[model samples]
Target: MTYEVLARKWRPGNFQDLVGQEHVVRALVNALDSDRIHHAFLFTGTRGVGKTTIARILSKALNCEQGVSSKPCGTCSACTEIDEGRFLDLIEVDAASRTKVDDTRELLDNVQYAPSRGRYKVYLIDEVHMLSGHSFNALLKTLEEPPPHVKFLLATTDPQKLPVTVLSRCLQFSLKRLSREQISGQLKTILESEKIKSDAGSIDAIARAADGSMRDGLSLLDQAISFGAGELLVNDVTDMLGTIDPQGVDNMLDALQDQNADTLMAAVASLVQIGGDYSQIIDALLLRLHEIALAQTDKKLVSDSAGNMDKLLKFADEMPAADVQLYYQIALHGKRDLPLAPDPRTGLEMMALRLLTFQPVAESKPVTNQSVPKTEPAAVSNKQPASTSTSQQPAPAVTASAVTNTASEASPAAAIAPETSKNITQNITMDSPWTDIVNALQISPLVKQLCSNAAMQKDSTFDVSLVLDQSHGQLLNKDRELELKKAMESLWGKTIKLKIELGKPSNDTPAATKKKELDSKQHAAETAINKDENIQALQESFGATIKPGSVRSRV
Candidate 1:
């Protein structure tokens, strides 16, 4: 008995067994069924994406003993021999090794000759892009007028390297990289047939590590099976792949959501003990954040391969959407700068701390005059009153610090107003100036852009209506409208009804006004530079020219 690796053992023998690349399969099947097969067929894609396998299957279809059809009869002598790689008429060439002109000419020497065993003399060239220029020229001559009794099947990872002359003569089929879900499904099916026990986490880990290649997935599966001593387990697979456990990722995220620095550091300690690349850990975090983001938009878009759908949905609800975006950005930059850090762990810790430190300011509750406690002003005097009936008491001296503290205590509402203004613009109403309001709103740039392009319409009611010019209608959407409404409500400290309509505004929008201001400033600056005494002297004395678009407004 001998052992065969999964990559080879589970290789797709026919088009039906192939995973992904359905577009290529459908086209080839239609061509074969219609008996309209071209003389030359080129398959292109990345490795393990079934380029050569498809070429082999197409060869089987062409030379199958029964007849030319999409579904070849495997029981036939020609099919079996082709499957075993011993068919007489089916010639397999490694274009990489035999790229010389002589080798190519010799390989095609028998192109005009009739097949001794099968109906057609099929040529299967793997990595055909590796052929030399002269070899391509030699092949191109035969391809232009390939004999009716012959067929050419070419496969390559890099089609851009192939000459157009060779390309025009062939029917090209591009194979697509398999998705992680597709690879994971295939792996599960194979494991079931092999009667190997495994868990979802282990299979998912391998699928992600595959990086969209079925062959790579199978290879990792094989390695994982052997490493686990026959049965695949999550712990063993994570150890083999050196990936943090999903629970460990969950713990880190939990610590982040709770703003628990101690718990976050503890999570890092656990990862350090597990021992893997910090960048990879960051990748895992980023992947989970992406899933959470998708879950926020639509739970259905988040795939099961991510594991723990319920937790993802929960995180999506518990975490603010803005915070998700912020964390994702930080993690991306942190991973890029990880190499420059003093140590991997230190870099990861700093990145994690950044996530906690820079979270979006939480929305504040509306405060009323009744809820605010007021304190009476303290009286201070440098001289004692002599009219007291009891013992005369000396007046206590008051310092500047004491006065400041007393003032702060007396007006808690005044203290909170400034902090509230930083997070959410206040005092905005239907009659407020749109330009000033647009500049003051604490919102994302995109939402701000939407608001800036809108002009407020006069109305007698409390509801506010914004008339957006038709030119900027593309920026109007339900999400942006909702965000704008929320921002206005926060600013006004009351519920606001906001309506956005596409039309011509009677007055210039904030954006248009700002643009006009900028243009004026730019023109003024350029005129000032042109009329400057020193600039004119240099221009006349040395023939110095001012570069176009060099002048810019300072304001």
Candidate 2:
């Protein structure tokens, strides 16, 4: 005799044999036991989830020779015929093939008649959603008021396609997909019963590959059994599914944690050489990273530690939370873009490089007592100098002392001096309030570059106009303006106004000119520090960089 496949051979013979669908089973069993059966029943779910099987079992239960009972004795001729799809009273129709209005009319015409040889005449219409609108309309009246001996069982994967009017006429039961553990347990029972030699690890691989479908798992198991001839092995199953071992995934992750590019790429190449699916490898990596993140926050959240939990925990400890989050984001994005790449290997490499580029570096130590060289200001006239032709041009006459005079005058004991001008640029001074405010903002290189070309104008209600040089006017961005305004308010203890206009500078005190000179130099220094590699290294190594407003000097 030809052998029956495991899926059909082990098909659930009774409701008790059904797995992961307790709610549907319980409702149907209770209805059968209490004689509270509905005329029409709808079973909805994905493929391989037992929707049609439940329909068949219900047909047997309703037509059993002993009468409609939940546990029909399989020994009875009526139950046997129903189970074998030979019962004269039971009709199984695939709506996909017979979806015409004429076919539906003919079927319903028979529904009006009483059962010939059983308690009830059952119509099990599978994929009922395929029926055309006209066909559905033709059967609506008969389905709503079918004869007492007729039962309608409709099954469909896509229930949303079914009309609401039709759905309202029947009792619907949605079947759920089985979980990995549930599938694994069921596979173990089947293998043991069949006396097939297999390992739990091999069964797990099949279960995961099945993705919550029992039929899929059994079909996969059948392939593995045939491939192995007599026994199923983990290695054989892994190769059959084109999936990498969990250990290979863990190894790849370890390489990532260590930032060992060579090792990671080698592991990927090894999987490719063995004909493993690169996409699945990436999926497994993502899942493992999630486990690592969980292990970081709570050790107990780590699942199936076995021997790899230690490595995962170590990775969690060594990496910062922000870095981990960044890695996860990069990996997800890479997965999305992987298909567009020429090859999976190249895609995986690009993803690894992205993570490496963003990893945080160790902080550096701070440099102290660094001094900047000072220059003497050339004499100036009341008229604008040639140097002032460009707004960003330096004022040869003004000195650093002139710019900081107000700040020093306001608080004599404030330690305000030329040496501390860098910090003073971050604050406003009482001396020449308007000029000093601009000088203080010059502490920021970006602001100084933009404002150097700005000549102070008369203050309006909310708008203080500055004569802007065309070249430098474009330098001011929204962020820089906001920062300047915030610093000015901190100095004045109230809101100061601002407006930009085109004009020339007013001949004021040489002190004001001197203040502008000092402000320019301080601003230049700040810009240099921002682009300085040495400063960045110091910041990363020792974490000792000055705050935005804090003073730093060359000693």
Candidate 3:
């Protein structure tokens, strides 16, 4: 015997041998067992996903020597010959090569004759979508009305290219690409049966690298076995696939969570030492952030085919849910924009710095005042008696550093008046009561939009009648209504009945009013900035210009 590749050696001989196509198998098997066989069967899917294999197996089932059923006896001449690809009755044609009208006419010329050896004369045309328009026209009549002893089996990777007439004439079975777990499990079974020494992690790496194709997975497994000198090691598999270690991804995430720029650089440095791909490294980090976000919602969502749930859960606990969401968005956007950078390393470094930049300002430690005297602290000296300060006066709030560090800190007293105002606003009786309520309600944007478009009317049976404008009716679905009702109960500390009706609202929605106000303020700010003497001087002297829509009011 000669050496056979894993893909060819492990080719599925029957429907039961196939993996991850139970739906198609069940339909074909039921059809065969009931003897309700269709004349033409079209199997469509991507490369190495058993499109041709299933067509062959169905041909075997149709022409088996023992009987015409789903279960073919492999020992019979018809089945064995068909399996060996030498069966006279099974005419396999590669439409990719023979796609001219003459070849199609020659193929159809034999339709008048019957099967010489088997029960059905099967024409298995692979890549049938490659056939030309003229070729399809030549065979249309024969395909639609073939002889009683003939069967047509068509396979194509791109079914979209096939003509509608041909598509309508056949019963189509679209096979799905296999999952990573399914491919991994099938690889493990083959490796074990071959007496190969391998770990589950190595097989899993190979399976993912295969990208949803079983034959591709087995082919990669063969290459991996050769590369590993007969034993599949996880390290060898990672090197073979050019995949980064999950631990490295975990470390990168930890450094990002701490906002430690040096640690992040060190992580990248280690990967560079090992010749890791920057694109793959960024992709892995994005995947980890996604898993962390999922874990935030449900802790058990932290799972993967590589069994890295522990790392996911660890990062999920270390990072805030808000930070995870923000990082996930940034990393996702960076992946697409990475190519725009001058170099891969530069792109990766910029993304790492961006993660640290967007970190919450509140999380950063407050800078100590070094200029204050040994007797008193700056925070206290600002409020101390002027006599006690004797020599050096405290810096004024108008200082450069104070303006630069505006978002870093605020007096606790600054927020007290707003809290009091909020309490007051909740109590006032006004015509447009929801404007204040919508601002204060801690609901989602959708529910807030739903609330903003609604007007309140008193009813005997309900706490309030909400009249949502007909234009915003789509926002007032059952789930959103329930969320708003729950938020209402939470806000008021009372269970209140509410009725929702769709009609024209009599007043402006809060969102619309807020937008209108912001537009006016923005216009005023733009005007002020443009009219400034210094700005006009810079533009006239240096040809400098301010960006459009960049002016926003502090208010």
Candidate 4:
């Protein structure tokens, strides 16, 4: 006898053998047990997900000589013939091949006739969505009102293509894709039954490669067994599938956490030399990062990481969650654009470099200067200072480098406060308070227009008082004053009292305001330098657009 492939060899013969479709099996079994079968049944799902298999089983249940039972006895003639694909009463048609109106009419023409061998004549049409418009119209009437002895079972991956008229006549059942664990378990069972030796890791690799399709998983297993000749191993499966090993991914992550670019590059080179996919490496790294993030939130979800869970959790604790999320996004985009790059290695390196370059800087060390007493330290005599005369004299002089280092270690904020106050004094002109308040209000368009022509009332206690013109003052109602106050406080980081007084218009008008704006713009442009670190980075790296009206704070 010819050797059968694993897929066909492990085909499910009954509902009990079907995996990962409990809902579908339960409904069909209940219908069969209760003798409440529908005339037309529609099974829809992607390929290798038991759509057609369920149809075959249902056909057997309907026509089995043991009666319409959920568990049809395979010893019965009807079940045996159906299983062997020679049942006279069950007609399995491929709508993809015969998708014409004439073909549909010819098939439906015999629908009115009684069953030739069993209680029901089942028509199992695979890929029914392939039927043309005219063919669908031709079968609609027959599907809606088939003879008592006839049943229709239509299966399609794309059910949306089927007309509503055809869909309304049938009872639809959608089969779900099997999960990874379910697929792995089923493969293990099949391999055991076939007496094939394989490790769990190899089975898992095949399951992931299959992507939730049982037949695909079995096909992958068949290839793995043949490749192994007898024993299946994880390394062999990885080599066959061109998948990177979990250990390599773990090592790459370790390199990243250590910020050891040399180690990262070496690991990547090894992966490339071994014919591993660079994009898959990035994808696996992203998966590991996600696992690490979850592990940080809950320890139970980190069970699948072998012995690396503790290390991953440690990395997670050290790194901020935002950094992990950003790297994950970068890795995902790298995977998407990997094929477009000149070489996969180049793409992978670019992604790794991007991640390393953006890692957030660590927080600054705390200032540790010992505070002197408010009253100042007590003075000692110069010639025979208390106890210093008997002690060995200090070194002749301190080096300039030592003095500079001591001063450099001092807190810059404390050292710079006096200098900052002097600069603030010089810049505070007679009209500085008014101008600053106006500029702060300019942050919002509405407030800017309302206070355009307002005049400033100079007072020592009140930072800057605004007297709005009649029309504009009316716009700055009580609610608007509160809004302006909030915006000013946010900008200044302190409260500046503003008393809004309605009065006659000042000489400063909107036309004068326009002229001042142009002068201010020119002054800003002349003072602006391209050496600003943020602007330079934006221009050189990302080519950011700097709009004219955008505000910049004085550093």
Candidate 5:
């Protein structure tokens, strides 16, 4: 006896035998039972995802000798011949090979005739999209109005190429790709029945590599069994698939989180020994980072099926969320730049090291007894960075008098004078406490714009009067205003109604404040550099000019 491939050998004999396509199966089963089947049926999906198989099963169900019913008796001659690929009435055509007008016409020439043996004459055409325009034109009429005994079963990976005329005439059943768990469960069952000894980890690796195709999973399983000398092992499967081990990904992430350059490089060396695909390693690392980031918000959402939940939860607790987000972005950019490296290993190494450089400094939790100084604006800014620790101190209540004449006077405390209603831009006074609150609000970008650019006029009983530049009228909407209001409510711990008004803003919007802050820092740094004796001496002796825009404050 000749050996058969697992995909062909274990083909689904009926709807019950199929996996991960309950949706298509249920519709087909109902159609078959109700005897309300359409003349033309189309199956669409990717390769190895049961487009052809479902067509074949539906063909058998329609032609079963037991009668015209959904539940086909496999022992009957019609079912046996269909299974054996010798059913006379069941005409199977590979449209990829027979896509010309003549071929299509020739196939449909006999459509008007009745089925020879089975109750229905089933024309099972695979890769129907390969048919040319002329072929589709030729198929349109017969497919639309075929004999009562004739059923058209079309399958294709590319349905977009098919003519609208042909598509409109058919009932399309889309098949979905199988999940990793579904594929793995099927693999476990197959292995148990085949008497193949295997561990769950090896099966998992195979299922993942299958890329959501049951046939592909089975094919890989066959190759894995052969490679393992009839025994499925994780190490052998990993080598066969060239997939980096999950543990290696964790190790690299561990090294990155710890900022341990030596451990990171060491992990790379170990991967090099295994001849791992660096791109795949990068992808695995990206997956780990995503899981860690998700874990920070909801620990229960992190998956432990691969047995790494505890590690991820621990990393989430230890590594700053900011760092996790930064790592994810860098990893995405690194994949794009991976091919530019002299070698993948060196590229991966540089990316790993760059992650260490960008790791966020874990914020120190604020102490409860720490007093917020009322006099110093610098003190408030220092106490709160863009991202702070879990332990937060309630923001000090700000009074209107806290700001200097420059910050508020830039934007007058009084209602915008009628003269300022035009395009006149006023410079707000400095030292306003509003900018600090805006920065600390931690709202989304849209709401941030509304808050940042608006100045809060002192309102009674925790209410805020917001003034936005009239030019930004398009950005203001009821939804955005509500979201902005909610953010303020959360921050101040009081229900505050926002009174929105359009005028020339006399106060510094968050955008203006940020620009002012940057300009001030840049000027101070330049002045300091110019004042340095060493810099001046070097310039005097070497006739060197400080490079334009080179002096930037660390702030």
Candidate 6:
């Protein structure tokens, strides 16, 4: 006996056997049970999404020997012949092969005649979009009005190419691509029924590689079983699919979190030995990063079926959420750039290096006066002898005022200075301006933006009150608030109790102050430009006029 491929062997025979098309199945079942079926039916979706299969099943339902009902008796001659693809009344046409006007007219010529054996003559046209304009024109009239015993079933991967006249005459039911979970569930069921030795990890890898297509998933499963010598193994499937092992991805991520470049390179070398596809490798890494990011938002959101929830949660706790997002973006771009690189290996290596080079330095222990570096400023003249008199000039001492000013100059929020560094180090009282505290804390831009739009006040020694502006209410969330609270507590060297409320700020927010400072600087720059002697000369000699909004502050 010749072997049949899994895709063909496991084709759905009825509505109940079909998976991940509940909407289409429900409508068709309703129509059949109520005996209100339409003359023409059109099905549209991507490849491998059950467009042709549903058409075949509907054909069976309409022509079943038991009667015209949704539930067809498979043992009946009409159902058995339909399932065997030998039903005389079921005329299956591949529009792609015969797309001429003559072919369409010839097929429709017999539509007025009654079905020979079954109750109805079912016309199942696959890839109907391939029909030419003349063919569609020929099909329009018969498809719109056929004999009492005729039913038209048209299926296409591209419905947009179908003529509006033909489309308007049919009751279209679009089939959706199956989700990963849906596809995986179906695969598990098939494996159990087949008694195939398989594991969850291998099934998941195949399902993910399927990319929301049931036919593709079944085809891949067939290949995987053959590759594994009649058994499904994770290593064999990963190798067959050219996807990296989940453990390998985890190792690379662990090395990255540790900032161990050597370990990361070693992990890559192991992957090279396995001969995995670089593009798929990057995709796997990106998927892990996405999971880590989601886990950071909420640990419970991560799926446990992959047997890596603990690893993901640990990564979420150790690696900063910002780094996860950054790495994901870099990997995504790197995947796109892989094909243009000199070679796949070089592209992946350079991308890994870029990730390492740009990763932000881990936060250091709280900066103390003792840890601050003291050194001489740049010499005025390089022409002088090596040590003629540079050493004789004592370096200026670093002061708290200088530190405060230097810190304030680093960020726009630092424009509102309230206390010296020495005072803040010794004691951070409620009287200290929120801007000053915010400027000193190390946090992500999202948390910083949240702080910039809120007014902070002290309710007790360790209690803080925040009034967030109503305009930026969307920024108020638990994760960001927790991150901001942690940064502030670290800077103050004490645990803080925070209470947030949505309303108008009693004082100007840091964002408002920054805007004001920016406007003042813009006015100063414009005034200076207007008063410049060279500018005046140019205006007088050449009638040159400064364009509005062109002047920008350098300071």
Q: lDDT of all the models against the reference? A: 0.77, 0.70, 0.74, 0.70, 0.73, 0.77
TM-score per candidate, in order?
0.65, 0.60, 0.63, 0.62, 0.63, 0.63
Decoy 3 TM-score against native: 0.63
Give the CA lDDT, 0 to 100, for residue 184 in model 1. 92
Error of 6 at 534 (Å): 40
What is candidate 6's local distance difference test score?
0.77
lDDT of 6 at 308: 62
After superposing candidate 1, which stretches have Cα over 4 Å from the reference?
362-555
Model 5 over residues 48-95: C-alpha lDDT tens digits? Answer: 889888888888888887777767888899998998999999999999
lDDT ranking, high to low: 1, 6, 3, 5, 4, 2
Give the worst 10-residue stretch by lDDT in candidate 5: 363-372
The window of 10 residues in a row where model 2 has the poorest summed lDDT is: 363-372
**Alpha carbon lDDT at 75, candidate 1:** 83
lDDT string for model 2 (1-555, tens) is 897999988888778788788899999999999999999999999888889888888988998888778887777998888777799998888999998889988888888778888899999999999999998887678777778888999999999999998999999999999877778888889999999999766887898889878899999999999998879887788888888776677766666555444576676777677777667767767776787778767887764422245677787765555556656766786687788767887777656545443443321101000111133332233355667667524553244544344333323222222223444554345345554555555245455545555666566455455666655556667787777777667766678676655455564322346556546654654564455343454346434433332222111
Candidate 1 residue pairs that clash: none
Q: Pairs clashing in candidate 6?
A: none
How close to the true structure is residue 347 of candidate 3, measured as C-alpha lDDT? Answer: 73
lDDT of 3 by residue, 142-166 (tens): 8777788999999999999999999
Candidate 6 structure quality by residue, lDDT tens digits, 1-555? 887899999998988999989999999999999999999999999989999899988988998888888888878999999999999999999999998889899988988888888899999999999988888887888876678898899999999998889999999999898877788899999999989999878988898889889999999999998899889988899999888888788888877765545677777777777888898788889998988888777776765444366787888876766567667866786788888777999778656644553432221112222223443234323434667555534433334455554444334333232222223443555467887766666775657777888997546644789889989999989998899888778876788788888899988988788777657865865685565444454346434455333343534
Please report the candidate that would top TM-score against the real structure.
Answer: 1
Put down candidate 4 lDDT per residue, 190-254, tens digits, no spaces: 88888888876788778878887888998888889889998888889989988877667777776
**RMSD, each candidate, Å?**
23.7, 22.8, 23.6, 23.0, 19.5, 21.5
lDDT of 1 by residue, 104-199 (tens): 999888899999988889999999999999999989999988899999999999999999999988999888888989999999999999999999
| TM match of model 4 to true structure | 0.62
- Between prediction 1 and prediction 6, which has the larger TM-score? 1
Residue 316 of model 3 has an lDDT of 65
